[model samples]
Target: MKRQAYRPILITDASRSQDDQLTSRQRRYVMMMGVRVACVIVGAALVGTRAPLLWLWLPLVALGMLLVPWLAVLLANDRPPKDRHRLANRFRAGQQTDAPAMSLTAEERPHKVIDGEP
Candidate 1:
């Protein structure tokens, strides 16, 4: 019997390491939080100095403060979507359900006969 040849995965098809994904998510979370901090600073500065259109500015800044952390947590915890090819088998199986499996009768099926000589 012949052994099958080993196949190597391509670098282009490889997914990122867990550490790399965690590092990227951490960076994104920090950047968004930094923006939230900026929103807080601006709101405080506006309150202290009677800025123009304070009502509008305050609500917009307040909205940023309310939404950023929620979004940051969601994004930070999210992982990348599965590759499309990973889902191909499921779709192929679904398509096959449209057709009923073929069945063969005993006479229609292939068979081997053996004869013994006395």
Candidate 2:
């Protein structure tokens, strides 16, 4: 019987750890919230000073205040998607793909052999 070549998974192809993803999401949420806070401050200042184009600017600032939290929540809850190749086997239901599968056949797997003639 012919033996298939051994394939090794590379660390470089691995996805980011959960903690790393969470930390980044948190940073993004905080930054967006800060922008929302800035919009509030700017709107207050514009009202206090009666800046020119007040009619146009207040609505824009109000829009920012309204949208940022919703977007921030969405982004915070989002996660990186699984790689296509990783799911190919799962959905194919026995179809062979051109890409190498990340597993070994039974014969190719490592195992202990014993002899009865001891």
Candidate 3:
């Protein structure tokens, strides 16, 4: 008998709470920035140690000093990626309604013409 993979079923919305997602992203940003700051300190140390290849170490130092902050800030400010499968401008959240969804384009697929309206 062939064994099938155990796939756990879960709803998209139930997968994560908004606050959890936000806090996780925030943690990632802080950790990455910390690493970037460490790069600068390490680069400075390398240059101070006068590692025979000053030429190589200098660029590393400059890169750590310059690019790291810019990238760190960009990542920190980055928003979560959009879900392509989800629709846009469908309806406002927390909406309550007893009726089923009514099709806005119920006029017919080919679009029939009325006698009075041109």
Candidate 4:
């Protein structure tokens, strides 16, 4: 039988929640701007006869386009940089666990051992 080696797991901090939130907010901002731009273009095309009315929507479309980048930066800055290990441990504690296991595995491990030592 081959002996399966069990090594100690070194868990590092990763802010998954913050990352997810940032991604979600970015998607929303992009979608919002896309929709607003499409609406403005379509509205202008449809109301070609009403020049003044169609022009009125341009400011809103411009504002939406301008706000996308600003809001993305704002939301990204708002997220606090927290220690991932501590955060995960806190979550595990709420679930009645002592220590949260780190997700790192041998395959995904980046550090290399030289001369038969770590």
Candidate 5:
């Protein structure tokens, strides 16, 4: 007799289950480093070859050399924007978002006496 096995169920939430191993900061650092490598390669290649209008290309090379690291560092240090969302039922219901305006009538306002003796 042959035995059969059932398929395993995937019950995890899709968003979390498929999340990247790297955090946002790590991802940015990785991406910026990749771009930085490309910049270095291109700059070296440009300087190595006797390309025409070298003066025109000099600024590009300069920018890559000077800006790439600064930008990479900046981006790597940046944080992902915070997410803000309100539950549909919790909002616009009895949940008070704003303070109710005080009633014009004095009776509506409660008075507290310090009762301090001099």
Candidate 6:
């Protein structure tokens, strides 16, 4: 049996690639906002009802509302905020424009041998 040498795949320019990457804080802020909004709506519904669950819903709703400001602050305090333009420029500078498509070929690809070690 003959061994076949494998060549590495290279991307020449990555700047032109279209991809979305959000920082941790940004993702969290978005998630928190969505949850808060849902909570507010639910809470309002509970408050308007004469059901005994109003007690529970009101507090939950209030807590959710309270979280909005805190979440905003957290988002504001993010050490490195997400910047789409900057990230795009960086992608361009790094020559990573068109990213590879997600497929089994990517996941199942064999690892390259380094330093001639198996």
Measured by TM-score, the strongest candidate is 2
- List model 5 lDDT by residue over 1-118, tens digit each: 2223333333531232223523665777777777778778876777889678878887786787778778877766655443233233235666665332332345445578697896
Cα lDDT of candidate 3 equals 0.64
lDDT string for model 3 (14-73, tens) is 335678767877887788778777877877787788778888877877777687677767
In terms of TM-score, how similar is model 2 to the real structure?
0.76
lDDT ranking from best candidate downward: 2, 1, 3, 6, 4, 5
What is the alpha-carbon lDDT for the whole of candidate 1?
A: 0.82
lDDT of 1 by residue, 1-118 (tens): 2333444445866788999999999999999999999999999999999999999999999999999999999999999787887455446853652222234446654689887975
What order do you get sorting by TM-score, best first? 2, 1, 3, 5, 6, 4
Task: Return the top candidate by lDDT.
Answer: 2
Question: Candidate 5: where are CA atoms >4 Å away?
Answer: 1-22, 84-118
lDDT of 4 by residue, 67-117 (tens): 656765675456556666555655664477532244445665457767876
Clash pairs for candidate 3: none
Cα deviation at 77, candidate 4, in Å, is 4.9
Pick out the ten consecutive residues of candidate 4 with the lowest summed lDDT. 1-10
Each prediction's TM-score versus the true structure: 0.66, 0.76, 0.54, 0.33, 0.49, 0.41
- Per-residue alpha-carbon lDDT of candidate 6 for residues 22-48, written as tens digits (9 for 90 to 100): 355567777788888888778777767
> What TM-score does prediction 4 earn?
0.33
- Candidate 6 or 4, higher lDDT: 6
Full-model lDDT, candidate 2: 0.88
Clashing pairs in 1: none
Can you give the lDDT of residue 95 in candidate 1? 65
Return the number of clashes found in candidate 3. Answer: 0
For residues 60-97, what per-residue lDDT tens digits would candidate 2 score against the true structure? 99999999999999999999788987676547766756
